[model samples]
Target: MSTDTDRPLWLSGHMAPVPDEIDAVGLEVTGTLPDELTGRYFRNGPNPLPGNDSGHWFTGHGMIHGVRLNGGRAEWYRNRWVRTKKLADNSPFLRDDLTFDRAAVHANTHVIPHAGKILALVEVGFPYEMTPELETVGPCDFGGRLTTGMTAHPKQDPVTGELLFFGYGFMGPYLTYHRLSADGELVESRDIDVPGPTMMHDFAITENHVVWMDLPVVFDLELVNGSMPFRWDDGYGARLGVMPRHGDGPVRWFDIDPCYVFHVGNAHEDEQGRVVLDGARYSPAAFTAIWSETGGPVSEVPAADAKDPATAAASTGSARLHRWTLDPATGKATEEALDDRGVEFPTHDDTRTGHRHRYLYTEADGGAIVKYDLRTGSSTALELGADMAPGEAVFVPAEGARAEDEGWLMTIVSDRAGKGSELLVVNAADLSRTASVRLPRRVPAGFHGSWIPDA
Candidate 1:
């Protein structure tokens, strides 16, 4: 057995991988689970097999933990590994001829319900289809209409129910935007022009446009053998692009300060016709520190310049909520920091995904679920205490809700000692615990998830 000191940070403590799949029923609940909150919560993340390490936290095989709730009770909880080609026989993602086998990737980043199917997603591979029970049905290519890898962070338009997403590769034609109709038909695909290939993890969409983050992290061939081949390249520069949602007009690119954004909160068009975007922004030094700890390549930037005091002091990575306002009239972009607290996994009401919104929800690095009210320029947080670490706070709107934040925030809070886990349901309006279902085992900290309601 490997000693704790010998293991990578991703393989130790709360980030540790579970041994195998298991299930439990009639879980213990601390408080009443709202009757209207009936749904299945599924979360996806990297979980390397026992005695196996994928070299990096982001490259491990995909595993999903699911919980079922109905009639104000926790019904069942189970976990399963996504049966990808890479997971079945350890197939190589890159073939001998230097081409990618899209199915041979760890679809471990995010899980969302699109159309009539639940998809497990990763940026560099085809999405794996999962049944309502969390069984793998195989990879999907949208009836063979999707030719490139699908992003894990697709945005569903609340008004039209269309899914808008993009795919990026290290090769030419680096980025391509795609759209899926409300009924799940792959309707549109357009090639987006970008300078080069970068680790474009997430993007934003407004009422009439698509927002792209072309940051400085570029792919390097020399780092191909490493855990992640991308690194911070200050020379590449950082810019955000705004393109029409339905027109052939050229994208308006606005040069911005050097930074990185892994997740976007929301985007919308203001009354003055400006595109406003919100996300968790990471400084170069902060990104470098977190990247290095996650088994990524060390930045070429000097150690003196790459050491961030604020980031070094936090257990989770440091990223502050920020906003950018792009004016089409003057072709200029203005940036501002919304908060100084280190936070990630920003979420908002889906009804306001591509429209003006009043509230934003996020998980603070210091173990709290924070709510930001943009209208009042104030924020509130529900502290999870020292032993508990909260995952992404996914917002679920209450039925017939009039207020923007009249809903519940569902998240998985894992114990730092790796003892156990629980599904925490918090009232979005008051930030109070509505219920807590004790999980059967300690769930390793993972990526994004979704609340799939029964139709």
Candidate 2:
């Protein structure tokens, strides 16, 4: 019954920092649903949580417990794998939401408030698109609800307080275990595969081995959409798959295979399983940081274009690679020359005092946010950025009557004129600056965020 709170307040999740304000739902939806949509952030900096309405946009990473149970109000939650497009017949936007072909919200539900009730889940967006109206064809029509190309994430069942479900159903990097219950049901399901889902994407389980990343995928563009023109990485190979929390056969494979470009940026193990990978490297990029306990971080990737094929055919081009570390026992390498800063604090960790773990991963045009530092050193960054520079920050503390000792790090400032989304609030441990909540309404650039700080 540890009510966690040494002082909880460190937030930033964004979208709509430019183009006047992209318009996911702001600037008042005029003239038939604003085009090129953008704006994001469910809750913007400085402890925002009041009648909250930005609709929804939380790409990934969400589920922090800190010291508080549920009422401590810092439980945290965020999820998104959703894809509901229809740029006019590009497909995937079903439902009668208006009239679109290939539609699928996969999973969508947002909330934030803790130690009292509010740390829920459901946001299985898109994973290699598979729709028959979204599968599961054995249900009703009365209320009609059958969608499970599966995609869930939430952990906390050292012994079951519920909420212990990890899913995957768009195939690979395998992970599917359920026991949600708490009104959401899914009781007990199976099928857990972890043998290289071709560069797995999200993971962090520590009771005993789930540190992950056997990264190496050649191509599957994740169902093609905006960019990623194709090329999963031919002859691709990278293994470090460790699946043993209660694993069964072949769950402890490690073969960083003549690996070429490992991009796994987070993993922690220390009870003797000995695995630590925080990768970033491929075709002259530079930033290798591997501490492999002995198995392999893999390697063998070199071919094509050598460096910059016209910004690699411009997909918003960015390849600062080069960050290595592989010592499963002498497979060594190390490099770090990345700190363009747009987000800075300590890199990653202490999502709420997990202590300090140091995990800062950056990838955009769509989504990527990795920050960790529970209470030590994995070599921190505490800040990361990508996407029109930077436009999301938050940290507000001084409640009850607004006491003020400092708390507020809200940010969003895009000068594109589409309508810049603004909400500046700073000072969570000297982030510098303070106050400013201007918004004429116009948010669109969606993806990632959750901080209902008292609602």
lDDT of each: 0.92, 0.32
| CA lDDT, candidate 1, residue 266 | 98
Candidate 2 lDDT over 157-208, as tens digits, reads 3333444334443344345544444444455555566543343334444444
**Regions more than 4 Å wrong, model 1:** 300-316
> Clashes per prediction?
0, 94
Worst 10-residue lDDT window for candidate 2 reads: 287-296
TM-score of candidate 2 to 2 decimals: 0.25
- Model 1 clash pairs are none
What C-alpha root-mean-square deviation, in Å, does candidate 1 show against the real structure? 1.9
Displacement of the residue 308 alpha carbon in candidate 2, Å: 61
TM-score of each: 0.97, 0.25
Q: How much lDDT does candidate 2 score?
A: 0.32
